[model samples]
Target chain A: MKSIFGKSKELEKNIEEYLDIVEEALLIFERDINRYLEGQYDLFEENLDDILTVENNADDILKEIKYKLYTYMLIPEARGDVLNIIESLDNEVDLCKKVLMQFSIEKPEIKDFIVSDFKELTKQSLKSAEQLVRGIRTYFEEISMVNEYVNKVHFYEHEADKLEERIKRKVFSTDHINDLCKKVHIRHFSEKLAYFSDLAEEISEILSVASIKRSI
Target chain B: MTSFLFISSGLFLGWSLGANDAANLFGTAVSTKMVKFSTAAVIISIFVTIGAVFGGTGTTETLGALGSVNALAGAFVVALAAGVTVYLMTCYELPVSTTQSIVGAIIGWNLFSGRPTQLDVLYKILGTWVFSPILSALFAIVFFKIAEYIVKNCRIHLFKIDMFTRIGLILVGAFGAYSLGANNIANVMGVFTKTSILASLQIGFITLSNTQVLFLLGGLAISVGVFTYSKRVMSTVGRNIFKISPVASLVVVLSSSVVLFIFASEGLESILLNLGLPTIPLVPVSGSQAVVGAVIGIGLAKGGRNVNYKLLGKIGLGWVLTPLFALIISYIVLFFMQNVFMQQVYF
Candidate 1:
């Protein structure tokens, strides 16, 4: 009598709210990246407060989601898997906040040659999140299409991996920048960007396994 | 024995049947609140009667071999003794088998009367009691696999699947209830089959025997038990134990029915006999035990981590104790009835 899908709608809404803030945070990151590349240093500094505000809001929503998940006994069969999904997505959102905060604290120099690659990396990372959100929505609304959206997330993560390798190689190969700390910073930022895609892939894997468990 | 009030003894067994065993048929539906208690009672009462009148005769023949209290006084005492034994044991948190109690009482009667209990028939009936749960577990495992395959290979929407499963559980539960009535009417109606006091009813063109009329009475008593006492059990322990999916619930119902029907069905045996195969023996098995086995089977298929062997161990102990208590009680009761009350239990 206690249904498996009873709390899914509430869970969907919470995840949606979390992802929305993450999306807003990503938009701010894009703006900051553009300002850095366009040589507008003061403007990027001014926009840091807005990204921080949205990240805080996302953190609040994530906290509420965890509280609800832990306290409320929803569907026993789905409770574990749903918690796993929330944890994975929560980690990614925290990473988004951390990356923007890093840019505000330690402003790294962006070379013009890799501006296109930075844009591409950001796009690929967001694409992974995009596919993951869609997949999660599918998991709640019409679970049959969950695999399709999950596959898309995997596809985007693969593309992000390639971009990460190219950006990292280009950062180290540059002759003008001989500072190891600067090179490592550039590579580390790219890795942080790639980490989003990794989380998305993990989400996809978790969803697939959860789906199988539900069927059984 | 000549008074109609004496039939109340058998009715008590019927009520006990409803109290303990009716949950097996409609527990999932009622516990889920999918079907109203009144609706379930009405449906089960109606179907139990129909199943008893039409299909209950086969199993009574087997139970008759186990006991056969031809005297009205003896039949009344046997049923009452079994009912009392079941009630007292249940109160002590022990699992009691009505079939075992009746068999034990009949054995008591046989020993008192100095008549031989046909060893071959008794052995066959005893064998069913041992094998019923095993067969039910095997059936459950097979059915669970089949249900899993259907869910996997089918392209049906999840909502549609949920809808289908709900309806399927109700229908199968009803069917299970019907078979339970048919098979178990033997335990309630067997002693009364050869009762000599009751008169047959004739309605113009149709005629009903005294035994048939007794079965109908027994069925009504069971329905009364379901409406009054069974609901309490359904709302408590039954609800907790039955919190499984539609597929697992269906597996439990279907497998329980299969074992009950197989053990009690003479028609299936005749068919096998005609085909020059080993005929399946007619025996009355415990529905409660069969349901337990079905639950265990699904548990095993799900990796056997959840099966409560300690509880099962307790139940096994009760199974051993049920008949021993009933046998001693019936023998003592029969002795008192014949001596103090000056009643003829045999001859």
Candidate 2:
């Protein structure tokens, strides 16, 4: 019984650490988003570099937890899905990293509304990560909040898509440049960064599945 | 009678100069469709008044010290000559510098008397005419190149480029205003300093400095100019200077300003002398001529064939003849008013 309690305490600690990583990633991401919104392109690039660094760190943490979970063979009912959930979480950070790297390269200018939406999404991502950790630590009562958080993430993601499409149309339609080199580059970067929204949805879907399967 | 005549004529000349020169601040921007005519007019008026009120100091001292105006009639003759020169320049659509016209008139007026100006001071003022435009053009070309390079290479989104350019223009406009304030403030107040008017006036605990009184008068004169006479000159400059692009306009403005500043700087004459060139003192250089020369330089840098020489030739002729005609007109008018119209010898 003591050994079981020790294992549970270790899991709780690991989950708490993961929450910290997500929160830090979101903060860096928020700063970059704001810098871009304010038209400080060079500062935005620097902030993006910091975010990419944080995302890499978060990826390492997610991987460590996945390895630990595998070694322990914990959460029997959710065993098969643990790797998927961890990978999805890491993929979210991975998408963020990729988007930010492109941002550093292209140094694309994001509009205010889009940046605000992105910041909101980052906040929701952090909330979902925290709730996921809570749900994992036998905090069943907090599980319901996870659904709302995930829902908010998906909602912001949809809004981001609409805004992205509008920007894409204007960019494609413009005749300022003869060829579409800059347009293609900026659009591709925007599309990739936008994939984070989808990753968040997959994370929520995976969590919902884990919750349902655990009950059964 | 002498004090009143001198003051009114000087104020009238100052007002006319403002009306003609204010457009230089906003004309290119307006011509390029970057800003509307009405918007440019209002902005120029407000900013010019503000600049004069808060900023026109260095140039005032330069004008005051340019030559000796020993009598009230000397001041009156100088104002009349400048006013006629400015109006004649306007008629020809030649954007001559009000500062230069005034300086030239003062010089012309000084030449009439036996008191020969110190050649060193005369040379220093003349040296500015040669250097201000050339230096301004070089700066404009370089600055425009830098601004263009950043815009093209930074990979900033298209919308953001437009947004950034708009903001950059506002900054450029502000800088132009500050330079105008610093340099042209001298033109309006130099006479007051020479005449020792408002030397020791104190109202409500605040002593009005010569510089401060000059600024107030400059501001008022500029306001009158903006409302009454700025439109015709604004339109003429807008239409005549090449089909202006925003980049080109920015280059013209920034470069002309750089030239104005270099001419306005202290020890500029000494620096020129050190270089073994004729030192031009802190003379009031022509803003319009500097801008025109800078524009021509931009044209040359782009390649010589890029500019319209006929238009440029016409403008150059206007510059040479404006003061000559003003001097002629004022010389004739002063002669006529004194000899033919009045039996009493006023002077």
Candidate 3:
């Protein structure tokens, strides 16, 4: 964080701290979702509480960054772009908390046959987020590496999309689950998980646009 | 007291110069909130005074050569004519040039006195007026390109670039003010020096020349103008005109300063001549024209569609009318000063 924002120490510290909270929430979101896939529903519930707290913390930091930039006239030339990039980054944390809350309340039971596919979707979605983390970190510290990780995010997002489509077709075509309502629920949750990767991809594009106006 | 009254018209023009041209110095920096108004004011006042006291001679020599108004009454009328031209233009919200206005009034003085106008020297001053803006535009284009390349290719973060630019604006603005003072101070105080009416006085240990004392007073008048009236014009230019990026803003300002400094610097001209290059003329170039040219340069570089041709046409009209009006007023005032007052306006 310090390396990425070395010259402007105060703005560097604030934005770095905000990105840290967001990454924290996202890591917990990744871990909790995987734990649920492994049948540790009780432990997932405990992690869900931490994710919610971090999400709120991320929200507060976003507001704080905006206020500081306004009140102190920080980064007079690039303040608008900096605030916008952080806002987009913070949205990912909000999505994580929302997705975790849905899982906690729904508590959908997965059938044995499609367990491997569901886990595969989870891994791809988490990969998108992990690549997003690296892209953002690189955005601050080393712009040369930004395109590298942002490209990976796009690749993982495409993979997540293909997995989601397969899950949808299989669930609707086969009568393995037998209950129509349960089949729709499983399909809806799978699509939502795929949408997680879509969010990461959206953030990557946002970062790209902001960088165009920022330095280059 | 009589000497002060004799120099009052010059002081009036000095005040107007300070008010209007200070916008060129610190307008972008203050308007963008990169520097506070008070901070800009302090820096501008000190530097302009220093520039006037130390380096005000080069361009004054140009104006002095163009026409030597040897009588105090004649110099007084010329300053008043130019001052009135600037005042009228300011009311119409036109950025007028004191250099051009005073040049026109001197031409008017020559016409009324039946003296031969030095067409060759006049042509050189006129040529610079034409090229100042064009040169400024070229400088701006080159500077903008270099700045754009640096921002895009450098490994530095965006926020830090912005911070650095803010600091850069302050430093460049101070330089601009200094150059402005050195060049434009002649428009305010040049005519009065021909009379040698104000004798040198000792202030503490420093025995300043009459010309330097007159310049110091004129510089203060300009400073007073900057403090009291520049904000309104600065705000208007900052918000209403070209919505430029920080880099573009810096490019425009630095470009104008380069042109103004070139016109005022004999040292730079001799260097060019020593290198077997054509020398730059030491003329009183218009700061307003240079800034306008810079803005146009950035506009063209950004694709030219955003150029405000209507306002520019209006400003060009103002530039044309400024000299003509000053010439007519000075001719009229010189006739009355010579005939009714029975004053010897030309030696």
- Regions of model 1 farther than 4 Å from truth: A1-215, B34-36, B202-207
Q: How much is B292 displaced in model 3, in angstroms?
A: 2.1
Identify the candidate with maximal lDDT. 3
Reference-based TM-score of each model: 0.69, 0.54, 0.85
Candidate structures ordered by lDDT, highest first: 3, 1, 2
In model 1, the Cα lDDT at residue A177 comes to 82
What lDDT score belongs to each candidate, Candidate 1 first?
0.76, 0.60, 0.82
- Highest TM-score, which number? 3
User: Which one wins by lDDT: 1 or 2?
Assistant: 1
Interface RMSD of each: 6.6, 28.5, 4.7
Error of 2 at A112 (Å): 53
Top candidate, metric DockQ: 3
Give a tens-digit lDDT track for model 3, residues A141-191. 556567888899999999999999888888888877888898899898898
lDDT of 2: 0.60
Clashing pairs in 3: A4-A141
Residues A121-215, model 1: lDDT tens digits:
88888788878877766665466678998888888899999999998899899997889999898888888878888888988899888776555
In terms of docking quality, how is candidate 3 classified?
Answer: acceptable
DockQ, each predicted model: 0.08, 0.01, 0.27
